[model samples]
Target: MISYEWRGHFENPEVNALHAEGFDHAPLADDWWGQVTRHSLGWVTARRDDTLIGFVNVAWDGAIHAFVLDTLVTTAERSRGVGRHLVATAVDAARAAGCEWLHVDFDDHLEPFYFDNCGFQPTNAGLIALGTSAPRHV
Candidate 1:
């Protein structure tokens, strides 16, 4: 069975590994998960048998809005309700924190998952690139 934590400690590198496999991104920065903890209102981690399998980051604008970011699960654990559980935990955390809105932005391929499974509504949104690369951020 999968277990979860509303954490007081971070598993930064392990979470980066999970993110790398789950999102098919190149290895993320070793300290990236640290930044997530520093910025988050709260986060939830999912595990089974002491191995990290999933994570979700709940970041806020310090007012009424909270965004769900970097929801991930190990490739072997996908479609097994890990994503759903992580998002649900994040949403619950956001609500408990008194956030008035919970938002998420995801790629097209994940629309059904976000909409059908996680109950996010479709809305008009936009993105603007302010730099060629976030080279400093990685």
Candidate 2:
């Protein structure tokens, strides 16, 4: 069975490994741990027995909005419902935290999967990218 854990601790090695695997690109500054803890409420990981298969981070503005960020399942683990489970769990957490809505900015190429598999739909009014005048956040 697959197990999920909401972590109070940051797994730096796992974060670095995922980054090296091309699933992440954020620069890990020296204060990375502090920054992550300050901005994020928790991280969740999917494990099959002793191996870590996937992970995601959850961020909330505390009062109003919540965003799902940096969710990744290793390529080898794709299509096995791990992604779905992770997303469902995130949705539950968002609802429990009193968020009015949950949002994630995803790859345009994966629209079909997000819609068909995860039940997300494109809104009439889409997203905006204010390039480089602000720090490029993913």
Candidate 3:
């Protein structure tokens, strides 16, 4: 059985491994504990038998707006509702904290998962690549 928790205690390596597996990248030892503690409104963790299987970070603008970042589930755990549960748990936590807006940005391929499955509506949004050349006026 998978158990979900908001702001749950986690060790960096387990989360790092899960993230690496989910995102299909080599694991980097990121300071997840410090990052979440310092910047997140909260985070949700999904565990099965005490092993970290999923995670999602909720970052807020210190008030009404919350952004969902780095939603991840182990590759072995995907397609089984673990990712959905993680995001759902994060959404509830944000709403309970009085956040009025929840935002998420994802690649084009993930639209169905974010929209059809998770109930996110389409919205006009903008992004600029950091450390890259700025856009030139026509």
Candidate 4:
């Protein structure tokens, strides 16, 4: 069984490592990730005993809108409703914080997961490429 919490303590390395496995982002120094999670409106984590398994962050503009960022669930834990639970927790937190809108941006591959599983409605969105896909190799 997995448990969720609105936690304040987020240790890097553990988190960066979990994120690397979950999100496929190259893991490096976690100083930046620590700073961001520390300042987020809310952060949710999933744990089984002492192991860090999943995480997500909620960012608000100090108004009626809140965005869900970095929704991650380890590959081993995927397709087991863990992602949906994380999103639901964030949504409830946002509403409790007086937010009227819960916004999320995800890839097309996740459309069914977020929309069908998590109950998010379809909407037109945009994306931009900010850097080269294949940086010059050495």
lDDT of 2 by residue, 1-138 (tens): 888777634456665665555455554533435656788656677887766677777788876677777777877788898877877777777777778877777878767666777766667646556876756767
Worst 10 residues of 1 by lDDT: 129-138
Q: Scored by Cα lDDT, where does model 1 land?
A: 0.84
RMSD of each: 4.0, 4.3, 1.9, 4.2
lDDT of 4: 0.81
Question: With candidate 2 superimposed using the best TM-score fit, by how many Å does residue 75's alpha carbon deviate from the native?
Answer: 1.5
Task: Please provide, for model 4 over 45-93, each residue's C-alpha lDDT reduced to its tens digit, 9 standing for 90 to 100.
Answer: 8887777778888888888988888898888888998889989998888
Candidate 3 accuracy as lDDT: 0.91
Return the top candidate by TM-score: 3
lDDT of candidate 1 at residue 82, scale 0 to 100 = 90
lDDT of the candidates, in the order given: 0.84, 0.70, 0.91, 0.81
Candidate No. with top lDDT: 3
**Least lDDT summed over 10 consecutive residues: which range in candidate 4?**
31-40
lDDT accuracy of residue 95 in candidate 2: 74
Question: What residue runs in model 4 are displaced by over 4 Å at the alpha carbon?
Answer: 132-138
Q: Any runs in candidate 2 off by more than 4 Å, and if so which?
A: 8-10, 22-33, 124-138
lDDT of 1 by residue, 8-117 (tens): 34567887788789778887667855676678788888988788888888889988899998898888899999999889988888888899999999989999999999
Better of 2 and 3 by TM-score: 3
